[model samples]
Target: MSMNDDDAEILAVARAGFLDEAQEMLRQFEQGLLVLEEDPSDSESLNAAFRAAHTIKGTAGMFGCDAVVSFTHEAETLLEALRSGSRQLDEDVVAALLESRDQIELLLGEVQSGEEDPGVKASSEALAARLRALLGATAAAAHAPAATAPSQAPATGALGEPEDGGGDGCWHLSLRFGHEALRNGLDPLAFLRYLATLGETRALRCQTEAIPNLDELDAEACYLGFELRFDSKAKREDIERVFEFALEDSDVQIFEPGTAPAAFEELATRRCGEDPKARAALFQCWHEMGMRFKVRLEVAAVTAAETEAETPQAIPHIERRVGPAEEGKTQKRSDRRSGEGERREGGRDRRAGDETRFVRVRADKLDKLIDLIGELVIAGSGAQMMAHQEASPLLVEATQRVMDLVQETRDGTLALRMVPIGETFGRFQRVVRDVSKQLGKEVDLVVTGGDTELDKSMVDSIADPLMHLVRNSMDHGLETQEGRIAAGKPPMGRLALNAYHDAGAVVIEVSDDGRGLARERILAKAVERGLIAEGQVLPDHEVWQLIFHAGFSTAEQVTDLSGRGVGMDVVKRNIEALRGSIALSSEVGRGTLTQIRLPLTLAMIDGFLTMVGGVNYVLPLSAVAECIDVPAECAAQNERISGTFDLRGEVLPWLDLARFYGISPDTSRRRSVVVVRDGQTRVGLIVDRLMGEHQTVIKPLSAIFQHLKALAGSTILGSGDVALLLDVSGLLNAAIRNGQQIRQTGTAAFAHAVLKS
Candidate 1:
């Protein structure tokens, strides 16, 4: 029949839904296959892998996605055999299955892109043949079976076919459609048609006794059921895959030939319908195959003794029994037992359910939400400003409450975009596996603090840089097994990815217990490249930093993995693009640790407000150690002497903000110093005034302001004035450098002044 517009629209929507589901199923399939590689005896993982392929095939059939259906059918065959313990799980089988999973994904992508290349077809067929070989099937004859309905011949015995039924043995399927199946864009007949491509359909029975009269029947309501006998060498999962998508709204049961009666009882109790005749018909059909179904009924007559045993209202009551065809009704027992069984099973499968419960949200949506929340934060600050200026008690009180609520909302919304960094870290597993094998090295990737959460956007942006670092560590930092043994270390090299929250920032460290950075070699390379002054005796930290200079490498020879002298500079640029900083620490014979520190959220933060030379600045509250009043003597002391101040007996290196930023200090102002720490290092920042705390919503600066590394971002204050949010770590580092310069100059100035005086 020619398709109508309505039919076309329905099919279009179904296809879209199928595409979305197919992607998720493919992900599960990949993850399950990876797990199977580690622990082949993991039954749940095996089942998950099988279910993913089975589900994709079943859904694809609904949309007439023959490519996906056919490819997945072959993979599902092997997964089923593994599921039933008929086939052993080994590295070869797992590798082939993984390849098959990829091929299925490629096929689904083709369906979406509407592109069919001959090369893709060839690759798919090759993978499918490999899978078929694992299953002991010949590729050429795999698609040769023809279907025949059982109505053409007498019903065979319980075994479905002959005892020696080489290729004709069939799997039995029972399908009962829910009333809304058609309304949900599902066609029961379409599934059977798709199933035919897998093998032969030997028998078909359509039960339509529940269809209403013409005047009462709803055209969209489905009242169809079918019992089909399908002939194929496919496993049980392959047969059930034919009806996978229909199971949600319909009751579907697949029975292999000679299935026991107890299995039927379990299936019957799981289904709910008002048609007793249909239930009896199902059993009668099974009885025809030499299976017995027992029915029990208890009835008692009303008696005076029974009435005396209880009140009349409480007396046992009986209704006359009628045959199913006459009454056309039956009571559906509550599925409490089945529900309990599910609950028990649920305990074992909670992880799968948890994974399904999570919704994959788009990154752009999160960005939009964060942008809106940032604006709300600025608006809230404006309201507070107006309330304070009005000097009305009620307005101030109301605005304070509003500000509190806004802060809470802002935090909660921002958290929606904070996912654990572990996901980004997990993707490197495949990379490490493949690259290690290629490099002829044995490396263990140990990850910690994966539970540490960071902004989702930042996490995504950092993945490439992190991958580069990990690859560098594996290739250069790690030594060969023989070299490692000679160095008196374990033969297997170790690479680690760790993350933690530190001083208001998320610190990610990638380290390896292998050959560390060769400082002398790096310095020499930097000198040869003119990246540094020749013969400069630099600190080890500065030497390590030279590795990040563009096109700088110490390797004398180039290799595919790491020697072309690129990547590290790009890694630094990428990390810094996220408003973050990277540092390196290495000991000659020990190991190298590359640390990255980034803001928890790029959008907003609680800030300690300070004024430097009449300019407002915000410091992240989490990094502020404490605030101290600068003594008049100390403020009035010589400018050079101001670098080091005795803070409760300990000498603290202080940076005068006005001098550091090239703004003249207001000498008459009462100076306060805010101590800030990055990790274990501390620096004192002297300001003209401490303006208490403020809510700081970070607005990223334009590319023109990219050179200002000391300023993390810009923010709008309560007075609607733009304030620069200070990068605490950057400021601390600068303070340390400036303090060193001042100490040298101060000594020289003191000596000259003493001689002149």
Candidate 2:
């Protein structure tokens, strides 16, 4: 059927929501599988994994993503077997399930793209076959060992009859759809059709007693209920999951084949409310459907005036007689119902609290909000500037108060985008598991300080780089079990991911306890690649950095994992592209640690403004340790582009911005040194003037200026002039590199001479 524009739009939004929810489910699925692999006895994790897969399948079926539904069903079946204790959990089964998880992800991607890839389809089939084979193996092993057999006995019944008087050994289901179900794009018949795929529908009936008169009918509202008997080997949970997508407002009751009679009475009362006509109608329908029970209806007394009042009268009292055998079962059922009532009430309270506490917002909407906030900050700055220009105390004070509020708003808005990095860190559990297995190594990943928060955009960007580093650590840095044992270390290697906030930046460390970097081999590779001169002496730190050079590898032979020499350099580039820095440290016999430092956020920052010549530049205020007037001696040597300065008995390398970017020096303006720290290193920046602190809304530079050194981005100032934002890490690295070159070549004046020329 063709859809109208509004229907299409609603479907699009729903599809997007389904895709997002599917991704989260996939994460949980993978995490659960990992936990289960570690401890097969963890029933909670097994059930969680099963539910994730089941949810994805059910939701995908609703959206008509047949490929996803089909592929996930195969995995779901295997998970169900594991969950039901019909199949044993083993390494092979876990491996196949993990691979199936990956295939489902690919299937979901195909759904998102609205096209199916032949290759993915073939892969899905192969994985599905493998999962079936695992199930087949379980079946074959059933008779071999009592331990591997199904933990629960099969239901006792012939094909056509249950021993407990449940006709046809079929499950009975009562469904009353919500009023908005049809309007919400749900078709009652669609769920019925899906149920057919799970098993055979023995008998079905649709009740129309709830439908109002044509004059009162709402075309969009659903007023239908259904009763059916389904015969399937699938568990009750699986059948219940078929209706998961509509559970929010629908009333669905699933009865096992042997359910007692009182349950049916309760269902009847709930379905048919107080109206006498509706109650009579439902009773007649159930009787026609051959329900194993009877109802006696007695009319209520009413005055002629009450009957003529035009309002619908209350229903007559309906009573059912219970046999002794049924009465005891009814009492037990009542107690169970009491307990379930309490649990459901608690669940509802918790859900209500959660609904009030958290809101699901579109990412693009948040981005738009952030952009608007940035504009507000700029406008506030302009207003404050104008107020100060007026020189009226009252106006200045009012503007200042507004600016303070603006700053607070900016901070709070940005905090909304801050998410804990643990979510990203959690992804590596599967990576470490798979990569270690592929390499025939034993490695345990330890994650610490995962609650450290950073910008969501940054978290997304950093994942790829972190993945590369993690894989590299497993493939290259961590030695095999035999190698570790030979070195007197534990047979299992340890790879740790740690994150924490350091000086307004997030510091992420990936460290391994295995064979560390070999300095001599790295130096030789550098010389062979002509990246460094032969026989040149350099510090250990400098040698460790050679691995980051493009296409640099010290491995004698290439492997599937790392020896291609293509990852580390790209990792470095990606980190730097985020205006972040990467540093490496290693001990010969110990292990290697690679640390990445990134700004807390990229959209806006508290900046310390400075002027070089006639142009304004901003430095991240968090990086500014202190600002000092250039001493007379250093100020006299203004001709030098780069030099060292003494601060509190320590000498620090300093860069003159005017000369570094080739801008003409403004000798008339007194110079000041702004000391900024990047990681553990500190550098002093020489600028023409300090313009105090400002709220800087960062705007990206044009592609043409992307390669421009030390300029991170551009921002507009209060006076409507563009100010360049400095990349503190990049500037410090440049100054330190220049200092190293000068010391090596005895050309401390080389940079100054180049500027002069």
Candidate 3:
């Protein structure tokens, strides 16, 4: 084996993945343990635990991870015994298995760091010895997890059996490449092509369903997976051998087609029992046929007869019905691309009107284009003023169309970065599964609105914050099975990570069904920490939010999971730094939902423009609700009312642009107010005039204005003046919450006196 250190390193990475995967599987094993701990007869949980341990042992061997293979070998031995009822899937057994998982994880960490601590060897060996003892004297001598041992002795269960026995029919081997294989500089197709070097293939099919469109595909990623039906007398070992190099890089499923049907039958029969006698055969026959057909056809199964018969039978009808629609859409798309292509080609000539030319720039370049767009917006504002003053409509219109195109380009470019959150959501399943076992809790991650897309930057940044919230929900919001049962709740807890668009921002909510946030605890702690006033009366939702304040912890004991009082505050700050907001709501005994609302992206903010003292201001359009005319007469009625305003039947809280910031007003007779809301707070901004909608290319505020409560960011208006982009929610909240204490006490009594005064 001339496998150099590079090869060893590659193999090591592969082994690491196996260890990681085994750790994941063991976590699943632990969940099964939880179920079996109570009843111990849950067949599904037992099978799951057995399969997980088996996978860990088998996969560890393939990568030459001797420590992992040997340790998991013992775990597998016990899990097999548990499966066979030789030993029960008991609480102690499950705990031992969980401990093994933890040890395996430690071993993996050591492997990652290039060497294991000598202490690890003794501890791991002791754990293996425990597994061997449970394996009994009947177990084979070389009961190691790997086949690489000098003796290829049968494992504990399959003792003394030949490697070639008990499998028939063509085994369809499906392998899905992992990201690591490509990173290891291995060509995945080389593995597949190498498989043919084993023997003649009966049939083969490469599934490209997951292969993203080339335009959307990552060149460095493997999307196509292979399914091969090999015609050979190869044992499961021989069959599994073709993929030895890729054990960690591929999800290998080696099952005989005929065996699948039989196995399906046996399992079904075991569960259904022959109590129904006569109908059992019929049911099983139907089951076998349906199951086999399903496996054969998969979702892509289209019957040959149906295609052959239906094509001619339905062709004329299909042509009559769908011909126009299909042709029309195809033609439209073609024309659009062609027209756009020609314009781009023309623009490449670089003439005065060459602005129409568009090149497909790299995304990074497009980002640069966006930054240049921001600068261009600034320059264009100056150009507009100069052109307008020179009285040139052509120049103005030309500049105006350029502005329009720039806006359109910006929109299209930003849309490119908007990816659905489903990818991030999918990666969390393993996380939930692993963490749930680590804490000895039962939690299932349910995802909703996964198709909701956001900027790539936002998606990358939002993942960890969402994870923390979800983790907090699982570790703290959820309770142990006993606790849940005592609380009259379902034994199993659920944590849902949901994302959806609201207005112009994406809102991600991590909700759990367990014991919700401790409202009283958070309030008491906040008061004790002097983060809030003592005896402060606030909504329960607001109280739950106090957990997010810096240096806050509600955990009775600091476990490995949480209660360090460090997570939530950082989670809040991370979201806020992305120009987002968070809100928490919980019912004392029910559950808690922590929500994060993030702006569409940093590249653009849809803002509503208005004249605040004759100078323009930009308020995020997502936060703005409506605009109303404020008569000059009732204007004074709201002037001294601090920030509260009366609008129709609503006692709307208001922030006067003229007074709040001490900016001088133009003293106009007519006035307008823009009503806005965020989370739970609502505010009205009183302005002198309503300027139309503007695509606010946000320019970061100077350090001097960064701390300003009313302003979020600044942008250049079409009028060639810098307008402050207001944080509507912040303005009104600072006025409302802060003003609540100073609210001229007894507002009703004060109202009469104030009016009379």
Candidate that would win on TM-score:
2
User: Highest lDDT among the candidates is held by which one?
Assistant: 2
> Once model 1 is optimally superposed onto the true structure by TM-score, how far is the C-alpha of residue 316 displaced, in angstroms?
40
lDDT of each: 0.73, 0.79, 0.64
**Model 1 weakest 10-residue run by lDDT:** 329-338
Clashing pairs in 2: none
Q: Which rank order by lDDT, best down to worst?
A: 2, 1, 3
Global Cα lDDT for candidate 3: 0.64
* True lDDT of residue 276, candidate 3: 33
| Candidate 2: segments with Cα more than 4 A from true spot | 1-3, 137-166, 183-185, 273-280, 287-320, 323-347, 736-757
User: Once model 3 is optimally superposed onto the true structure by TM-score, how far is the C-alpha of residue 685 displaced, in angstroms?
Assistant: 0.5
What TM-score, over all chains together, does every model reach?
0.78, 0.89, 0.57
lDDT of 2: 0.79
Q: lDDT tens string, model 1, 1-757?
A: 5457788887776687688888778778877887788798898988998888878887887778888888887888778778766678997898898788778878888998989978889998888878888876433343323433342222333333332111224556767788988887889888888888677766677877679999999987999988666666555545555665555456666665543333444455444243333444555554443332233211133344543443222212233333454223121211211223353245437645876888656568877887888888889889888988999999999999998899888999989989899978877776787688788898888989999999888998999999999999988889999999999999989999999998779999999998899887887788778877988776665678788888888887788889888999999878776767888989876889999989898888999998887899999899899998885545766374335556676655666777767788776867888988766556677888999899888888888997764888889886778899998667654544444544645444322322222
Off by over 4 Å in 3: 1-366, 377-393, 531-534, 631-634, 638-641, 717-720, 739-757
- How do these models rank on TM-score, best leading? 2, 1, 3
CA deviation > 4 Å runs, candidate 1: 1-28, 60-64, 83-87, 111-118, 138-172, 182-190, 202-227, 241-245, 253-363, 631-642, 732-757
Candidate 3 residue lDDT tens string, 1-757: 5547666776655555555566567667766765676567788988887677656655554444567656765776677666656664555566677678778778767766778788888999887777666666554232322232232222211122222112223444545676556765556665655444334455566655566777997766777665565544334554454555454455555544343232322322332344333223323233322222211111123355644443332111101122455445434433321213343245334443443663323467767867887776667666766788888999989888877777777788778777898878876765786688888888767889999988888898988888887777788889999999899988889889898888787888888888877677788888889988998786665676677777789789998778889888898878877888888777778888777888888877777888877677888888888998764434766544343455565565555667666677666467777777776556566788887777788888889877676577888765667888877545644554554433543233322322222
